[model samples]
Target: MPTEETQTRTGEAPRRPRIRLDQPLTPRRKLIPDYDPEAFGRMSERIARFLGTGRFIVWMTVIIIAWVAWNVAAPDALRFDTYPFIFLTLMLSLQASYAAPLILLAQNRQDDRDRVNLEQDRKQNERSIADTEYLSREVAALRIGLGEVATRDWIRSELQDLLKELEEQQRSVAKGEVFPGDGDRGRDVDDR
Candidate 1:
């Protein structure tokens, strides 16, 4: 049954529940306004760059000269700042204060980029070293394998030794004598 608290003046039923359990609660309003940090950082860097340029110095000099000249030469009614020029000093101080922080912010961002690049370079060097070690190991394995394999020179030397032994046996048979074994041949050579 519907109560007076649940029903609208003319509504049959509410389209949605009074409270939602699945969704997150709405955040309370804050005094500070929302802003993108990256956008602010980029804008500060641009300001810092402009302030660092010689063109900005030249323009600032021209403006100061113009301000002093106008205040000194112009009639009393037209002059804004007098001989003291307190307003000009305040403006310069204000600009310097803002510029110092902006320049520092730009430097911080550049340092972050440098750190990331250095880390990436270190990882690349490590990978290269690992790859080099792997190649060296593979080359060593191949060298060890090749050491056991018979070469053409070794095979030729062995065949020549066998041929000389066969020729010696043939010579012995032509003389109607038996050929000596390798041990007896060595003894016979020593005796001769």
Candidate 2:
């Protein structure tokens, strides 16, 4: 029940004035009936699409020609919108006024859809680029790791060196090249 003055008392924090739903300060307006805005927008788009077609143009032309011919040719008693065709012009003007707004509404909706689509495409492109960069980095790391690992040619060369040393030792033993522990020094010096 605080009034506006009470809500703004000095030396204290200002408080928001409370609204009473049961007793509105201003006269209440009648509630408007609810309707679907999307449906209305779709209907406007349909009308705008129809208005842009060649068939609509042909039909409008035929109607206007027939109206003029009838009004000019018919008997005076039967004719309406005679000579000046002011009524026909007024009708066309009214049609144009409604059509312009509907066409604008349809264009606005299309622009919104295009904007959303472009944003999604941009996000997709970014994800694709990130994935490509990650894969490239992984490939580079694998190449560097493989460079430090052993290769088939190095193992073959090491095996060949060990085989040559073993063959030299076998030849020396077959020729009776004895050491001091073998006790063949007397036979060795007599042969020499």
Best by the TM-score measure: 1
> Model 2: runs farther than 4 Å from truth?
1-32, 165-192
Please estimate how well model 2 matches the true structure, expressed as its whole-model Cα lDDT: 0.85
Q: Residue 25 of model 1: what lDDT?
A: 94
Among the numbered candidates, top lDDT falls to: 1
C-alpha lDDT of residue 51 in model 2 = 99
TM-score to native of every candidate shown: 0.74, 0.70
| Model 1 ranges with Cα > 4 A deviation | 1-21, 169-192
How does each model score on lDDT?
A: 0.87, 0.85
> What are the per-model C-alpha RMSD values against the true structure?
6.6, 7.4
True-structure lDDT of candidate 1: 0.87
Q: Provide the lDDT at 74 for model 1.
A: 100
Which digits, one per residue and each the tens of the lDDT, describe model 1 over residues 119-184?
999999999999999999999999999999999999999999999978877776566465356433
- Candidate 2 lDDT score at position 134: 100
Worst window of 10 by summed lDDT in candidate 2: 181-190
TM-score for candidate 2: 0.70
